[model samples]
Target chain A: SAVISQKPSRDICQRGTSLTIQCQVDSQVTMMFWYRQQPGQSLTLIATANQGSEATYESGFVIDKFPISRPNLTFSTLTVSNMSPEDSSIYLCSVERSINTGELFFGEGSRLTVL
Target chain B: DQQVKQNSPSLSVQEGRISILNCDYTNSMFDYFLWYKKYPAEGPTFLISISSIKDKNEDGRFTVFLNKSAKHLSLHIVPSQPGDSAVYFCAASKERDGNNRLAFGKGNQVVVIP
Candidate 1:
């Protein structure tokens, strides 16, 4: 199991502003992922953040809207750009312990509310 | 289309009894399934998982049963405790090119009364 932490557990932001959420892991992990969970809905994968390369965005998400930065193996950040009321949701970061096993550990999650 | 589905939105069970949570998937490509439990204001914690090759896996008070042909899986908790009350999520993934991505279903809220 991994100990993951996210900053700004809850926040309220004005529309058109951007919020950056940080994820820090206790140990180094190979793959890091970002997901969005709408209220009373299932989670949707936003992107896969690579340590030294650009993040891979999912089908419905684009980098322009959710820019990701992974400076190292134990840390990554996801920025919600140009926030709108519809963009309000809980953002979570997860990491796979090993490639052979598909177990994922997640952070506490950052809840963002746009006004 | 929702690849993973948890038909029941909520369930109530008495403490010290068995609690069962059900999930179904529409994608046959899913070769791995996992169950996660979450409390309000907290991230989900991994509970149990089963591979496509296995029909069942158990861990202490929790057991996961998988039926590949029916594309269904279930989580069972024995001697349920009030602390076990939380939202449970079912996730499925397909191994492709050495990489795996998960598809999650809407969670089911379980309330256990003592």
Candidate 2:
């Protein structure tokens, strides 16, 4: 299993403000995933970050709204731009532990609250 | 359009009893199913998994049963213990697709009574 760590385990922010969440993996991985879990909701993938290339955003998610940076294999950052109340959720980073099984190891998650 | 669904939001069971949680999926492409356990303020940890080729997979006290025809799967905890209380998430993915993507359910909260 891979060890993933995220900054700002929890945060409180005002509407219209932007916050950047950083994710660091203990080892290098080819790809890292970003997911959001809203209150009482399932985990939704925001984007897939690949090293040395642009991040791929999922449907209903855009680069302008959630800019992602994958500077290296072991590190990535996700920025929430002009966040609104609806953006309040727990953001998590994960890495695939096995390609055959598609098992993922997740970070502790960063809980964000917007006012 | 949630691909994975856990119809039950919560469940309570007495110690030494069996705790069963069910999940259904809408995507036939999903051939690999997994269950994750999450404690408060922590990320989900993989508990068990079953590939489409097999209908059941068992670990120490946890067992996962998969039904490819119905696109449904379940996790059973034998002799449930208080430490087993946590939110369980059902996730699915296509092993051959090579997409490395997993669709997860909302999660089921389980409580084990003493």
Candidate 3:
């Protein structure tokens, strides 16, 4: 199992301001991902943070809105740009422990509230 | 489209009883299925998982059963304890394009009463 840590566990941001969330893993991992969880909703994958390349965004999400950076295998950051009330959600970082088992370990999410 | 669905929003069980959470998926291509437990203000913790080829996998108090033909899977917790109360999520993934992207289901909140 991999241990992950996310910064700014909870934050309140003014509308139109951008906030960046950092994710750090205790060990190097190949597959790192970002996910969002709205109030009373299931987790939704925002993007896959590639170590040395651009992130792969999911449908309905764009890099312009949620920019992601993966400088190395152990660290990644997700930025929510031009935030709106709709952007207020719990953002989580996860790492795949093994591709064969397809099990993921998640960090404590960063809860965002836009006013 | 929700590839995975957990129809029940909540479930309650008495301590020491069996807690069963069910999940269904429309995508048969999903080769891996997983169950996660989450507490408020925290990220989900992996509970157990089963491969599409296997029908059942057990981990001490937690067990996962998959019915590939029905495209459904379930998690069973025996001797449920109050500490087991939390939101449970089911996730499915298919290996495609070298990426195994997970599809999550709406969670089911389980409350274990003492």
Candidate 4:
């Protein structure tokens, strides 16, 4: 099991502003992922962040709207650009301990509210 | 389309009884399934998982049963306690692609009472 943490557990921002959420893992991981959970809905994968590489984003999400930065193996950040009311959701970061186990550990999640 | 589905939004079980949470998937290509438990304002913690080759996997008091033919799976927690009350999520992944990416269902809120 991995100990994951996210900064800015809860934040309120005005429309047109951007919010960046950070994820830190206690140990190095192979793959890191970002997801969004709308209120009363299932989670949607936003992107896959690999160290020293550009993030691979899923459909309906782009780097322009959601820029990701992975400076090293144990840390990554996801920034919601030009935020709108619809951007309000709980953002979660997850990492796979190893390629063999196929299990994921998630951060506590960053809840963002846009006004 | 929702590849993974947890039909029940919430379940209530008495303390010391068995609590069963069910999940179904529409994708037959998915070969691995996992269950995660989450508390308020906390990240999901991995509970149990089953591979496509196996029908049942147990860990401690938690057991996961998988029925590939029916595309269904369930998580059972015996001797449920009040602290067991939390949201449970069911996730699936394909054996190929390294089984890293997962598709999750809408969670089911389980409330255990004394």
TM of each candidate vs. truth: 0.97, 0.97, 0.96, 0.97
Ranking by DockQ: 2, 4, 3, 1
Error of 4 at B68 (Å): 0.7
- Give one digit per residue, the lDDT tens place, for model 2 in B1-114: 999999979999999999999999999989888899999999999899888899999999999999888989999999899999999999998866563678899999999999
Chain B TM-score, all predictions listed:
0.96, 0.96, 0.96, 0.98
The regions of model 4 sitting more than 4 angstroms off are: none
The global Cα lDDT (0 to 1) of model 2 is: 0.93
Candidate 2: RMSD over Cα atoms?
Answer: 1.1
What is the per-residue lDDT of model 4 for residues A9-111, given as tens digits with 9 covering 90 to 100?
A: 9999999999999999999886799999988888888999999889999889999999999999999999999999999999999998557455888899999
**Residues B1-114 of candidate 4: C-alpha lDDT, one tens digit per residue:** 899999889999999999999999999999999998999999888889999999999998899999999999999999899999999999898888567678889999999999
Q: For model 1, what is the error of residue A112's alpha carbon versus the real structure, in angstroms, after optimal superposition? A: 0.6
Using lDDT as the yardstick, the better of models 3 and 4 is 4
- In model 2, which residue pairs have backbone atoms overlapping below 3 Å? none
Error of 2 at A76 (Å): 0.8
Where does candidate 3 chain B have its weakest 10-residue lDDT segment? Answer: B93-102
DockQ of 2: 0.72
- lDDT of each model, Cα atoms only? 0.91, 0.93, 0.91, 0.92
Which predicted model would earn the best lDDT? Answer: 2
- Candidate 1 off by > 4 Å: B97-100
User: DockQ of candidate 1?
Assistant: 0.64
Tens-place lDDT per residue, model 1, B1-114, is 899999889999999999999999999988989998999989988899999999999999999999999999999999899999999999998876233478999999999999
lDDT per residue (tens digit) for residues A5-115 in model 1: 999899999999999999999999867999899988998889999898999988999999999999999999999999999988999999985574557788999999999
Model 2 docking category: medium
Model 1 DockQ class: medium
